[model samples]
Target: MTTSNRCVCPDCDWVVDVPVTTTEVFKCPRCGHRLGGGAPVSERHTLALALAALILALVSLWLPFVGYSASGVSQTMSLLDTSAELLHFHERLLAILVLFTVWVVPVLYLLAICWIFTRLLGSGPVGPVTLYFIRTVVQLRVWMMADVFLLGALVSLIKISGLAAVELASGFYTFIAFVVLQLWVANNVSRYQLWHRLPHQQAPQSEAGRAAHNQGLSGCVCCQAPNSPQHKKCWRCGETLSLTRWRGWRLTLALLIAAALLLVPAHVLPVMETTSFGRTQPNTIIGGVLELWQGGDAPIAIIVFVASLVIPVAKILTLLVLLYVAERGNDSTVKNRVVLYKVTDWIGRWSMIDIFVVAVLVALVRSGQLMSVYPGNAALAFALTVILTMLAAMTFDTRRFFMPTTK
Candidate 1:
């Protein structure tokens, strides 16, 4: 029912008048979901920040990240050390995930955004290549975790400071700067403006037009290009289009259940084992937090407690509630449910802090009984739980919540 100046709220389906001014930010009145926001950063500034980020990324990878010295032994690790150490220990899946998050995805994210920005700043109208790359950047940005990796590194440093002389190596500070600049770029650069400037050459029909044209249109999952019910492929991006948004509900449920089951051993079993002078102690997630609390690192303890314990539980419970509500066809709370889903999806990856901490410890603390740390069974289980929950969030189609309820 809405026209060019109005859009159906992604959260609630309420028609919203698009804000006019560069300073005017709009939030969905019913759900408080941000409908739109402020102006785009200047192209020159965004491009400069992006290039600086590239430099910092290289320094982060090339230099020694941090070092530990104790009992006449000293060891240092670089950014790649985490994945290399995991692979050396035959944890192939973890190594791949870490490598992807820390290296591959972040690089791809930076490059893809740079490419899109270049196109936006150029003389010619934006093409399919630019649109596809922009969409790709959106997907890759969520999985990039250099910032989380740094947090995990700091927590790991605090945990081992008592047992070893821990030094923040050059790469560590470089990584800190890199993370800050990266976030600045993300915040200052507006994707909305970029999308606006693009020619919309092959974009699917407007939401209002599609609905009025035929109620049977399917939205492309990739570029959101609307296609007729008889069409198998999206007209704009060529992605497959399907009418059944609920097609994979069962798979989402199954993954959620598996993640919940793993959350048990993830908390119950030891995540890391430490052996010092022939005295070995295994610490589960709760035990580790308590240890930090008893050791006077209250802040770090609280952080660990929230990241390792609270986040996983909250993510699982929240997703479960959302799935149930979404499947139930509740009309009134639809917008609230979308807000909840977004929050749950965003925070699920941070639960990997425990796993990252274990990786750094396993790699850098290999002193022979002076202090040696090894990955425990719970590390694998916990990592799997995080991965499963992420998958579950992705499998859930948020558009389903926006559908009209069938009474």
Candidate 2:
């Protein structure tokens, strides 16, 4: 059989015929995935956007998402305040996760992008490490997770709609804009070009290495070292590093179904209970938002509604649709599947907004039990639902949507 002389561009998905002459450099015709081209950024642009993303991230951490008022009690929470609260309430895990996802990771990623852009603006090729850094930034781009927080916030708002008095804060809008800029920058930066410009180091040749490489069977994708080609396990790490797609569908499906079952009680049970003077009222998500609205914080009501209710459910539904399409091998659903995949991927992290809001309130809204905030069990369940469903959705294979229709 003749060799199938074609290669696929990992970045842009462009397919090109490999030239018969090995001397000719094969490049992607669409993205020009060769070497020696700088990204479309000037030093000034890189510095400016970096500064903006940094500023926005910092500002978001210190501003109030919404103000809470009940029975003549009132307060506000900033992002950092919430993180501190999470640590205080023994929810340190979620708080740390929030801090890194919302505060630290985005800032670091943007900084890395800026550093690379500033160094390579008009200069030539960068070093291999820097190129690795660029690839890392690209890897991290989708996982930054602002949208997930947003969705969670919306879901929480909708759930709280009927109960509490809530009002929007300046920080809420700032956070939204922060998510937008991150997405804009990530989408605009071409990874293919970025990787092409970075220095490429060929694997060092050795007698044994050459013999293993020439045998052309199995190895690590990262180090290009050969392994047990016969046994389907890497000799070095005992890892199955062959080109095998993950095969955990039964397990993933079981966990997801379990989470889906828990989602019922998570939403049905009370998430928060408030007491004032001698009166006590248990609040579901719907009740809280209505209380906030009736208390004359209409904007906050809307913010809470959108961030906590609408977005989370939307994200969940999006994920469900994608999973269904993928599992069924529905080629006709490919476009919709892709759209849902993008949506779920982009917004998975924003679900943390409710977690942040709760965390901050639990930390800062303390008044010696006279007026205090604490997370209820349902809050934990709800948070878990959002997190688990998002993860399940992510583990779903979208490429299945593109497979040939066999059934």
Provide the clash count, candidate 1: 0
Tell me the tens digit of each residue's lDDT in model 1 across 161-206. 9888999899988888888888887777655455445333454345
Top lDDT: which candidate number? 1
Candidate 1, superposed: residue stretches over 4 Å from native: 1-23, 28-32, 200-214, 222-225, 236-239, 242-247, 327-332, 402-407
How close is every model to the real structure, measured as TM-score?
0.87, 0.64
Candidate 1: which pairs clash? none
Per-residue lDDT tens digits for candidate 2, residues 1-407, read 21223333322223334333233345545434431223354457656777687788888877787676656767776767656766676666676777776668888888888777777765765765565566568546645766656654554444334445767799888988888887777666654444334222322222331223234433333222334445565332233555324423444465477667766766677666555454666666666668778877787667666655676667666655555556574445545566666666566555556565565456445443455566656677767766676666555644345434322
Model 2 TM-score, all chains together: 0.64
Each prediction's Cα lDDT score?
0.74, 0.57
